[model samples]
Target: MNRNLTSQQKNAVLLSMAQLIAAEKAVIIKANKIDVESYRGEDIAMYDRLKVDEEKIEGMILSLQQLIADVDPVGKDLFHFTHENGLKITNKSAPFGTVLIIYESRPDVTVEAAGIAFKSGNKILLKGGKESLNSNLKIVNLWHKALIENNISTNWVEYLNYNRAKIQVFLENPTQKVDLIVPRGGEKLIAFVKQHATCPVIVSGRGNNFIYVDIEANLNLALKVILNAKTAKISACNAVDKVIINSNLIAKETFIKKLINKLLKFNVEILGDVELSAFENVSSFDSDEIWFKEFLDYKIVIGTVNSSEEAIAKINKYGGGHSAVIITKNDKTANTFMESVDSAAVYQNASTRFTDGGEFGLGGELAISTDKLHHRGPMGLQHLVTNKWYIYGDGQIR
Candidate 1:
């Protein structure tokens, strides 16, 4: 394994990667074009994430630049203590050794997530989906170029070009050391990794995120937030999937009608709970299982709740544990909902789409983790490091 590269060395490689990506923009785009054209899947979201343009290339370069500017995550002092026996001990941040990240069609992960992991001092093993193979290989080649230019070992960034069966075999019996595994995709992939991997897995789980429209909410504001959260980028994990409207909301019928009309403008298919089925355009769902689904498409579910507590209960019961929001003018109600909702990110009067690493001021993220242990929310360079205890003793015995 390539271990203990200095912060300067890592930053130099990242800077070189940014320069290379910028210089080879056309090449990268050409590669992504092949992946996009070859993708036979009907998943619009995956297709959207697979295709790369000049803007996405710029985003990749920007991610590298931002990661270069961020603080080094390794070697920071977390805690210190001294014993009376002249023994000193300190806990400091350290890399997780080799981190295996298994993800789906998003090609940007090849650059952004790898940059975060590399900057945090961990050797990364990226296993991107086959749908984006061409694009991923192009990016990985650039990573190799950057590493070689810096005289750093290319082992720092390795790509596992394996299929599902091969990946399962690798997970069950890794050829190299793997300290942590992060699965970033739909539930099936996360479940598959969890079921097979021997190492500890950090789940970058689904996002059946919800929004509650409180009785005191500004309907106009709620409408705008819902529209953006649900329609702005349906492919995003932070996109809102379910909406819980307080049954007693003023002009509830009028608001629902307006929301339905607005959503229909974007060609969104609206699903409704039992109470909401009365609305003309809203289709009623037969199974409660729909609440647990993360629809990465132009679809949304609208339900009704009696109170803030009820809304909180439903969100906790059915949400993806990713993000939930409450639209309200009441501080007490907002605080209650924010504190009560069990999710990585909770919002009040804002769009759930803001639940992102860069949007939350973390430059870029390795993954938007829903796991409570190790870390939650956006796993940035700072969040990627583990801790190690260092002890100093001059002929002192325990």
Candidate 2:
């Protein structure tokens, strides 16, 4: 079991980490370049996440800084009770002991996830993909140095440089205690972790997000939100994959045509249902199975729904449970859509891209969880903790 550190101790380490990352930005970038060059996969989204640049370096530093500023989540009081016999009981937030995060492509998770776990007083075991070995190793080196500088154990953040077979073995029979496992990649990775790990798993699931343009929607706003959500960052998990337009929408054809044209400007491939297939450049999908797909690319599907109820039902049925957006001027309709959509994050007349930890003001997040138990949305520092019960008694018996 890992002993909890004082808030001051954790903050000191985070500060040191931010300073070191900023100071060694060049070295980090150089190491990242090696990882980028070695990656030969044709996955555009994976490639985008694999490459680390100056902007991403700044982002790492900022995440650490934010963690330093946020309140420590460990040992906070949750509930208190007093008994007639002078026995006292209290519940408080506690660390999960150890968190094993298995992630891919994104090296920044090295900084963000570990920092969040440490602040919550949990030891983090990172299992980064082989594609980002060099970059992740470099960041882990910085984490070690920061720990050493703060007179803390480097065991707080350890990296598992293992392949798929090794990871499976370790998960099936962990040499060390792993209280919780978080899989931060795609469906396959999540499935693998859940299959092998004996511990509880928090699934960072896919984002087959949706946007519904309602009859009362501001068509221009819908277009803007859709374009931004889809094209601004195609590699993001919150990127829009499907857009459902109300069948009764006034000037619906004009709006759809405009949306298609706007998307085409960015070289996005437009796919549609049978009704929308007549539009130029819009290819019709053969099956409804495509609705369940999370296209982390410059591709989108446009479909039509008869009413808000249909839209809600379809989104709940097909969406990734990550994010959904409803573009409408009617606050009542927006509220209905937002509440009906079964997603981690729901929006009204806003881009789905804002389904992020930083944007949601959690400072930063360990993961954008899709699970309902324990947590449902952004798993920030405060959300990373489990609870413990404390009892005070002087030889009291039942």
Candidate 3:
């Protein structure tokens, strides 16, 4: 079990962590190189996903510094009111005490989680995926050094050095002293955590994001948004996985041809339904399984919907509860889709790729949460803090 640190101590530790991240850029780059070299000759996708360069290292440091400078989320008063009986009540931020974050290959999550936990005044215990163990170890070591340098209890940022068996024990042990369990990875990992974890689990599920183009949408704008959303970075959670086009717009052959040409330019494989088979440029796929799949590559699934209502229903049925974007000039259609889709984040005339905490200017995020309870959408510093009510009253008692 890790020792709990006071808010003051946590803040000092965060400052030191930020400074260390900034000063040891070269060291971070070197550690990343070691991981990359070790991962060579493995699956190309896995290697690319695990490799970190100098640019990413600098970005991580900048994100840490930004988080350290941001206003602390804890201790902020959320609400305060006085009753007619003269009883005063106040709802303010409070830490969850100890947070257990189980994440995968993304080594950047170490700093992001640390910053959020530090700002929200909670002790963190991190267990990252085995693939990025070396990179994660380097990051954890730097943070531990920072905690020691700031005279804070290093246990506040505990790193689990155990194997899969120990992780299973940690998850299943009812006596484990974890206030909250945050699982950041694929559906399988999230499912495992949700099933076995005795603590309150926040499952950040896979993001099979979607974008809908209605009849009222501007073709040019839709094309631009779709291209960027799918091609910006396919491996990211926010990237577009499926695109639903209104059948009315699909009848416009010239527009469809132009769009297909543009998509093919980037080697983006298209899997469309029978209705879209007329477009000879793209490939086709059957059933809704394609919509549920997150390619995490240069691939996209396309479908045709009869109306905006149908599009909304399709997204709700197939989406992985991540993000959905509606591209429409009609305010009613856009607003209706936004309200109807039961996803974590919904956008109007914007790419689903923008459904990220970093894009929302929160420095960086712990994960893109698909769960509706506890935490949803982007898990950032604000989400790290919970609220508690403080009452101050005179002699009047309820």
Tell me each candidate's TM-score. Answer: 0.99, 0.99, 0.92
lDDT of 1: 0.93
- Clashes found in each candidate (C-alpha, N, C closer than 3 A): 0, 0, 0
Pairs in clash, predicted candidate 1? none
List model 3 lDDT by residue over 1-398, tens digit each: 33445556666776677778778877776777777777644444456567777767776777777776677787789998999988889999888888999877777888888778877788888998777888889889988898788776677787886677888887888345889989987777888888888878877788888899889888899899999998887778788988888888844677777778888999988888886766786777666577788777888887788998898888888899999999989998888888999999999999888888888887788777788888888888888878999988789855
Residue 354 accuracy (lDDT) in model 3: 83
Better of 1 and 2 by lDDT: 1
**In model 1, what is the error at residue 61, expressed in angstroms?**
1.0
lDDT of each: 0.93, 0.92, 0.81
**Candidate 2 backbone collisions, by pair:** none
Alpha-carbon deviation at 388 in model 1, angstroms: 0.5
RMSD of each: 0.8, 0.9, 2.4
Among the numbered candidates, top lDDT falls to 1
lDDT of 1 at 130: 94
lDDT of 3 at 59: 67
